[model samples]
Target: MHVEPVRSGAQKKEFIYLPRQLYRNSPWVPPLWMEEQNGYGRGKNAVLSDNEYELFIARRAGKAVGRILVYIDRAWNDHFQSSDGLFGALDAEDSEDTFNALIQAARLWLEKRGMNRIVGRFTRWRSSGGF
Candidate 1:
């Protein structure tokens, strides 16, 4: 499997919707659809718009199997004087390889941005408790 940054509109949709497929027949409580869309919109979410962030999708055999969002909250870091990075909205298939690939991608991105510590599951909005 390979991980790619979510770039195109279709990939964004897939990133947002992959959890539905992954959690089908389970007790997952999905976030409101419009809220999810707005959260990812370029200027809709203050948290996302004011931070440095990227969304990624993992694909295997041309099918999406996992997704993640990595971000650096510069304002938070500046306030706390921390070199930390955060990741959230994690959804993945039950495959170790897929999980590793997705996490490594996030790690590398954060490292490139000078983050020394990694904090996670910083989910902003969701109907379910958390990731």
Candidate 2:
């Protein structure tokens, strides 16, 4: 498995679409396509409009299988007096290896930023909160 930053339109599309494929047969209700795209678009996500964040795509056998967004909310940190990194928009295949790889990537990304703790499992979309 490989984890890479979302750096291109194609990768971004994959990041947005992976969950749909993963949850298609479940009770999940996907958000509108455009809404998902805009949440990651510059100037589209209100809460994260001025926040620090990064999106990552995970692949296995050359196919996208998971996605994650790691972010730091300064206000939350200030209020809680902790530098905790948070992740959202996380989705993955039913493989433990894939899930571990995605989480390890997010942890490394956050650790580099000086965050000592991590909390997450939120969705990037306004409505859906889990995956």
Residue lDDT tens for model 2, 4-70: 9998898898899999999989999988999888988659986578778889998888998899898
TM-score of each: 0.89, 0.88
Candidate 2: segments with Cα more than 4 A from true spot? 123-131
- List pairs with backbone clashes in candidate 2: none
What is candidate 1's lDDT per residue for 1-131, written digit by digit as tens? 99999989999999999999999979999989888888875599887888899999999999999999989999889999999898888899999999999999999999999998878885345668654
**Global lDDT of each model?**
0.90, 0.88
Best by TM-score: 1
Over 4 Å off, model 1 = 123-131
Q: What value of lDDT does candidate 2 attain over all alpha carbons?
A: 0.88
lDDT of 1 at 106: 94
Clashing pairs in 1: none
